[model samples]
Every structure is written in C-alpha cells, then in structure tokens.
Target: MKLPNTAHTSRPWRIHEIAHDFLLEDVWALPTPGGPDDFPRLVRQMTSGSNTNDSRAYTALFEIRWRLGKLFGWDRPDAGIVARVPSLRDRLPADLLAGPRGPVFSSVPFTSVYQTDDEWVAEMANRTVHALMHMSWVADEGGGYHGQMAVLVKPNGWFGRGYMAAIKPIRYLVVYPALLRMIGRTWELQAAG
Candidate 1:
C-alpha cells in the first residue's frame, strides 16, 4: 500500500545519510508479511524480477520509456553514475562497505549497494535522475515482519523534475499497484511451496 512520505523520513534509515539531497519520491508497504529471516527471500524475489514481469501494462510502459530514453540519449553513459553524479556507494560507511554488497538484479537496471539483516539498498542512474531503492524489514503492529520499500531520487535538473512529475500519476495508479499485486501473489506461492 502507498504510505505517507513520513513513513520513510521518520525512520532512522542509514540511507538518509547518503540521500539527504534527494527527494523521497514514494514509500510503500509491501504485502510480503513473514518472519525476520524472510528478508533475504524478499530481496531475492525482487532482484530476480519475478514480480514485475506479469503485468502487460508495466511491460509496455517500460518498453516505451526505454525506447524514448534511447532515442533521446536519456540513458547514455555520459549521463549516468560517476559521469553525471557520484555513486551512493561512495558514501557508504566503513562498516557497511565491509559487509556483503547486495545482490545484483537479474532483470532490473539497479546495482546493489549494501545489504544487512534488516535493510538492503540499490541504485540506478540515468540522464533524468539518480535513484535509490531501499527495502527494509519492519515489524508490524500485529506481530510479524513485512517489507517496506522507499524510492529516493535526485532529478538532473528542470527536465528531470518535469519527467518525474509527468510520470507520477502513472506510477502511482498503474505501475505500483500492479507490482504490489504481483509481489503479493508471488510471495504467497513461495510461502505455500
């Protein structure tokens, strides 16, 4: 479910340190409720792209976005991390840096940054924005843990800001809801198996 921005900002996440300059674009409470040990399972499912592929709308949107990006040089090498903006990994604390870097996504564009017992962070960058996807295992009030995902972004400039604004409705209305349903169904199947 979509959550208030404060749901992320109010938390004492380590991501806040490195992403202070970025805006909190979205916060969501994932439907994958389970035990603490299930975080790795959740992260694995996400990185594996098991949930996002089922939606035709998502596929179409992504295809169009990618084509547009290619045609406009919006994802060109010169506009990515270390070219346009430094990587968030560069700001990782020594302890986080020493731990296992998170899993590399199989079907997504993001690169893993860090992983811990309760949290994982990944990053993606393009001409439009430098973005971070953070996932955390949080204990629910009803007892048991569920996943929380947050998106943070630093838009490139006016164009980036406009791009984000233009996509906000589509993201909230179609992409995220579809993804949530997929994740929930996938999690149910995994748990059942």
Candidate 2:
C-alpha cells in the first residue's frame, strides 16, 4: 500500500547517509510478512524474477517503458550509472564498502549498493534520473516482520523534472497498484515453493 513519505524518512536507515541529496519519491508497505530471519527469503524471491515474471500487466508496463526509452535514447548506456552520474557506491563508508554488496541482478539494470540481514538496496540510472530501490525489513510490535520499500531519485535536469511530473499519475494509479498485488501474490507463492 502507498505510504506517506515519512514512513521512510522517519526511519534511521543507512541509506540516509548515502542518498542524502536524493528525493524520497515514494514509500510503500509490502505485504511480505514473515520472521526476522526470513529477509533472505524475500531477497531471494525478488532476485529470482518472480515478481515481474508472473504478472503480465506489470511486465507490460516495463516493456512499454523500455520501448519508449529505446525510441528516445533515454536508456543509452552512457546515460546511465557510472557515466551520466556518479555512483552511490562512491559514497559508501569503509564498513559498508567492506561488507557484502548483495546479489547481482540479472532481471534488471540496477546495481547493488549494500545488503544486510534487514535491508537491501539497488540503484539504477537513465537519462531522466538516478534512482534507488531500498527494501527494508521492519519489525512490528507483535514480533512479526514485513517488508517496506522506498524509492529515491535525483532527476537529471529540466527534462528529468518534466518527465517525472508526467509519469507521476501513471506511476501511482496504474503501476503501483499492479505492483503491490503482484508482490503480494509472489510473496505467498514463494512460501509454498
């Protein structure tokens, strides 16, 4: 479900230290409830590609986005991370740099920034923006844990700002609801698998 931006900003996340300049674009409560130790399972399911793989609607949106990007050169390799903008990896502190940086994603263009038992972060960039997808395991008062996701972005310029504005309604109305349902269904299926 969509959450107030404060749901992420209120947390003492390590990401705050690295992505301080990025805007908190969206926060959502993921329905993947489980034990504290089950975070790895969540990570596994995500990296396995089940979320987008299983949902035709969700996949269609991405396909459309990619096709548009190709038409407009929005996703040109040089327009992405390590080229257009500096990587967040460059900002990592010594301890974070030394730790596991998480799994490489084969399903998407994002690169891992860090992974802990409770949190995982991946970053990506295109001509329009540099973005981060941060997943965190949050403890409920009753001892169960659920996943939370926050998106951070730094828009490239006037075009970037306009692009974000144009996509905001579509993102919130169509993309996110489809994504939430897809994630919930996949979370349950992973438990069965």
TM-score of each: 0.96, 0.95
Q: What's the TM for model 1? A: 0.96
For candidate 2, what is the total of clashing residue pairs? Answer: 0
Q: Write the per-residue lDDT of candidate 1 for residues 1-193, one digit (tens) a residue.
A: 9899998888888888877898889999999999878999999999987773578898799899999999999998898888888888899999999998888889877889999898899998998999999999999998899999999998989999999999999998889988899999999988988
For model 2, the stretches where C-alpha displacement exceeds 4 angstroms are: 52-56
**Candidates' lDDT values, in order?**
0.90, 0.88
TM-score of 2: 0.95
User: Can you give the lDDT of residue 39 in candidate 2?
Assistant: 83
lDDT of 2 by residue, 110-137 (tens): 8888998788899999999999999999
